[model samples]
Every structure is written in structure tokens, then in C-alpha cells.
Target: MTTNLILTNSLDEIAEFVTLLVIFIIVIGITYFSIRIVGNIQKEKLGRGNIQILETQKVSNTKYIQIVRIGKKCFAIAICKDSISYLCEVDEGDLQFNTDSSISKSSAESFKTIIDKFKKDKPED
Candidate 1:
């Protein structure tokens, strides 16, 4: 009878240990999934907070240019009679002037010179 009682007690202890382990695993899984969901939500919110500015104009008689500004970066998208060019991440300080006609070749050349000078002044990455 004493041996039977010991065996029964061992079985009960094992059952209790298994139950606790299952509960611990469920808790850890819940915590991990909750953290992942919250992280994704915050990332989406940050993405939506970004600022976008659009400017469109006719560069010349046959060419059109659209400028987009996101935060401190600027992009110039040009659509000629049959060709398209995308110039991205242009700094505002690199531009000679904030005028629509600044998209012209002469102004673009000046802007390129300014950017080159700025790059030369910065320390190497």
C-alpha cells in the first residue's frame, strides 16, 4: 500500500509540473505576440507622420518637371516629350534658388556645383 501511494504521489507531481509548464509557455507566447503587434503599430504610425510636398510645373515648351519634398529631401522628376528622368534626394541648400525656373539646365548645373563643394567639405564616411 505504501509503494502504491508513493507512485500515485509521483504521478500527481508530474501532472502538476506539466500543467505549470503549459501555462508558462502560453504566457510567453502571448507576451511575444503582443510585443510584435505593438511594434508594428508604432512603425505604421511613424510612417504616416512623414510630410510630403508636391510641386508641378512646365520646365519648357515641351518638357514638364514635378518636384516632391519629403522632410528635408527634394526630388525632381522630369518628363520630356518622350523620356522621363527621376532625380532624387536633392538637398534644398544645394539649390541655387527656390524658383520654378531653377529647374533649368543652367540652374541645375549651379546646384550640382554647390553639392560638389558641400560634399568636398564634409568628412569621409
Candidate 2:
């Protein structure tokens, strides 16, 4: 009788642990997705602003050269921790833009290939 009671108690504890774990996972998933949705919404809202940073190249840990678009014109600017200095006005014709489809395809293919390689290299348990 004692042995049976211990076994029952152990099973109950395991079931409770599993239930809590599942709930925790669901809450985490909800939070993750909610944050992502909010981030995308905020990006869309902020992206409509007149000032846009088109490109940035790092010169040092705290200094960068950036191409910025304000209104209809684009400018190259030097950005540091303390100040921003205008470098030059950029002609619209000089800019090369990557198409969304090409960028996404390349990124997806690279990521998938990396994961496939990792899985292939890993030994099965």
C-alpha cells in the first residue's frame, strides 16, 4: 500500500510539472510573438518619417559614415559619439537598391543551407 501511494504521488508530481512546463512555454511563445508584432508595427510607423538612414558604414567602434535621405535629397554624413558632420550631397542616380525578392531569397537560402550543414555534421543521439 505504501509503495503504491508513493508511485501515485510521483506520477501526480510529474503530471503537475508537465502541466506547468506547458503553460510556461505557451506564455513565453505568446510574449515572443506579441513583441515581434509590436516591433513590426512600430517599424512601419517610424519608417514613414521624412528622415531615413539609407546606409551606414562603420569606421570605428563609435564612428560611422551614413547616407541619409531627408525630403527628396540624400546626403552623406559622418556620425560620431558626439557630433554629426555633413560629408556630401548624394545624387539619386548613384544609389543602387537591392530588390526585396533577391535579398530575401539569398538570405533564406544561406540560412537554410547553414542549418542543413549543421544537422548533417551533428551525430544522432
Clashes of each: 0, 0
* Regions of candidate 2 where Cα sits further than 4 Å from its true position: 96-125
- Each model's C-alpha lDDT? 0.74, 0.83
- List per-candidate RMSD values in Å: 18.1, 5.8
What is the TM-score of candidate 1? Answer: 0.44
Give one digit per residue, the lDDT tens place, for model 2 in 33-101.
Answer: 999899789778876899877766779999988888899999999999999999999997898866553
Candidate 1 achieves a global lDDT of 0.74
Tell me which residue pairs clash in candidate 2: none
lDDT of 1 by residue, 59-121 (tens): 699897776666767888888999989866677776554545444434335567787999999
RMSD of 2: 5.8
Stretches > 4 Å off in candidate 1? 51-125
